[model samples]
Target chain A: MKITVSEKNGKEINVWFPTWLILNRFGARITWQVLKKHEVHITSRQLRRLVRAMKKCKKTHPGWRLVEVSEHDGGRVVIDI
Target chain B: METIGKRISRLRREAGYTQDTLADVLGITPQAISKWECDITCPDISLLPALAKALGVTTDELLSGKSESEPAVKIVPKDERRDIGDMMLKIVVDSNDGDKVRVNIPMALVQVALEMGMELPQVSNKDCLRGIDLGEIVNLVKAGAVGNLVEVESSDGDVVRIFVE
Candidate 1:
């Protein structure tokens, strides 16, 4: 599944396969160990700051819909990234 | 019990004796000398005199734990007034889909953007368009998603203004 960010200026930033960007932004090393658990990919431009900001904002407001993403396991997810 | 690790380490160097050399003079293993400095073990009472002589210090100085002192840390007054310039920019992007995204760039991030060749405005909270579009705007907002911006007007004389280019 993919997550899309709609900007205030009538534009959309589409984010596909957010796992890589998520883990990378959270400073989780994208190794074979993580890949075996879940799959993720992203665009050429890295989303390090984007994911970090999302996580930081989420800490204050748990319901801010800045970037929406899909989860695989449907388990209890704490969105640190 | 009062052996100072740093003091021992410093005295060892001043003596110009390698661990093995000191150990040889003291009739002990080099590993034992290492442990003494590392504080893993202490020297025997009888060995204090020889150790002090070799280390160029009196037994009182070594065992008493007095050595080179450190500078006292000066705590700055918490109330020192810092005037962050009053410049603030509020970018509220409302997409055709009805999602309104607002980003309040902090002074630090604004300075960072300026350093990266982005144009920033002078005066407090003046809005400057650096050719930032919707997609880029979203990305920038997403990058700064963690911070909440409080719009401060330029009237407040003591303030820091961040220019976004």
Candidate 2:
């Protein structure tokens, strides 16, 4: 799998993954790994909770969209849309 | 014409103040704020000044539905910077494996998939061939820049792409 991130400044960052990552349903695992590698510490459990809260937010507030999920200083997950 | 309650609710949300937050600033209960938003009761005239100030609006704007001053830029706290950015995720699964597939799973649903025991790769620094700070992405989008951010495809023809514009 190939992942490319394009910034507003026209700079692009790309990450290529092996075919097995997606074939094995390891999307979430890879996401956590990427975040951890970037020094954004968040546990698997916390990531699940954050995702659940984001889903709930989207369900209740259709006007709000899921933007980005980040870890705060106090282990708080910040979901911005 | 929009009712006063609706106006209050709209302004409050635009200011990024929840009912409880706005209530705390105005020394009122969240229930009171809810009632005002629900149009069950109006705020006391004496409370208009405090309410307006808390919401960063003039009493005239609150009462007459007009702003005499320029629109204020929303000031997001530095610690809360993570909460900014626009992202769209598009997924397409096309396989003959006789299993159910889905497309257009929002970011939230992707999390749901993970929670449901979908095994993903264990990414390490070596696996991450490239990386971008999410905050930079948010800033670029805020500055009115727009473009595709990321795209991924699986061996089985599943495609996932995330973009901001």
Candidate 3:
């Protein structure tokens, strides 16, 4: 997953995350856990704000899609696109 | 606004500890405790966790004067689409008074798994679902109709809801 951060005029800021990561459950959960482990606390309220921002940007920016594979029982991997 | 000193004083008193006793527990001088209670000096930031633990409250409660017992509704942003691949998904909505309603995905998402060549469990709750077409549900979801599937409220003011958005 790629996150882009840019600062404008030392005040305005912009943040973006991979749309596929936001749309996928396994990807989003893994990202949340990794951020928490690194002491970067992103609460649900903050996540909602991020999602709303992403939705607004999706209308303008070209979106990217990804296929995620999750491990299941019996040594199986389920692929979701 | 209550000063940190007043909050410390109130919590210390509520915990039934004299200034000297509290200082003894924290390994600080009684004068320092007196200063903290009088708003003359504040506890170091490093001591907040220990201070909160000593006062039998969370660090948030110690700082914000709001106990966790208060009803603070939190909006959780959830992505429910991944439950589709799991096949054995069950959604439950419940109230504080032990009222609940459950919805089980018997075959809707399971059909997606089937199409993807994943093995389905032999014994499943497939019979529980009413006459619903899995293909139609999948088509609707692909067409972006995957939100707020069902919602119902009981006469006892308990709400049970399921959403796949």
Candidate 4:
């Protein structure tokens, strides 16, 4: 997934998150939650990795601003898509 | 239009046959016959010939008016059934409060998630998820952005929350 961080000064910064979903924290657990709500299924390991990522990462940061987010065409993560 | 129910009951009475006797001849339960007469559904097309013969009528008579000489054909048309698996869909919604809208997920997407090694609850029914980040679900619900923060409880005790800004 790609996240665009825009500061109050009208400057935008982009960040690329992991895509394995099963291996990446934001990718796997968040995706699984979305899927499961829709009755979609995912592997246990993928879900575990995502949950781990979410727990380990902090939601707020000093340098980056969150302006927009998008998923890549495939599994890879890209910014400014 | 004459329904299957009215036709069956009229035919049975005209033939001087009890529902039980006709049901036995048709190899169906009496209740099944009753359902047919109540307009629940009609008998299968395969039974058309047998039913006509049993009622001392021709297939044409059963399908159309009493005589084939009528100008406008008044035959009954069968209801069309749809194959849900073949359905195609795209959905989008804009919400200011980020209220979680429950949407039905497709089986194909579920299979993809399983292949990716995501863990799921034991129950095999559709559910709703809550989160501000919906990279995967974007393809499913393409609303611009959700701003309402809410918590959704899983069938299990776990709670999924979405914080919309």
TM-score of chain A of each: 0.26, 0.42, 0.39, 0.28
Task: Name the lDDT value of residue B24 in candidate 2.
Answer: 89
Give the alpha carbon lDDT tens digit for every residue of B1-165 in model 3. Answer: 698889999999999999989898888899998899899998988888988999999989988987887533222234534433322233445554553334344333335333433221221222222233445545545444444443445565555443443
Worst ten in a row by lDDT for model 4 chain A: A69-78
Candidate 4's iRMSD: 13.1
List, residue by residue over B33-108, the lDDT tens digit for candidate 1: 8888888888888999998888988887777764334212222244542222222234443333333334444333
* Residues A1-81 of candidate 2: C-alpha lDDT, one tens digit per residue: 344444545565656655344433255577678776756666777665654555454554454422221122212121223
lDDT of 2 by residue, B34-89 (tens): 99999999999999999999888999999988677633223344554332212333
Q: Please write out the lDDT profile of model 4 over residues A16-76, one tens digit for every residue.
A: 7643433455556666777778655657675664354333222222222212222222121
Q: How close to the true structure is residue B130 of candidate 2, measured as C-alpha lDDT? A: 32
Docking class of 3: incorrect
TM per prediction: 0.27, 0.29, 0.30, 0.28
Where does model 3 exceed 4 Å of error?
A: A1-81, B72-165
Q: Pick by TM-score: which candidate is best?
A: 3
Off by over 4 Å in 1: A1-81, B1-3, B67-165
Model 4 per-residue lDDT at B58: 80
DockQ of 3: 0.02
Model 4 lDDT tens row, B1-165: 587578878888899878899988888788977888898878888888888888877888877635455422122223332222222121222223332222222323333333464332221221444222233433222232222223455555434433321
What DockQ does each prediction reach against the true complex? 0.04, 0.04, 0.02, 0.03
Deviating ranges (above 4 Å) for candidate 2: A1-81, B70-165
Off by over 4 Å in 4: A1-81, B69-165
RMSD of 3: 18.5
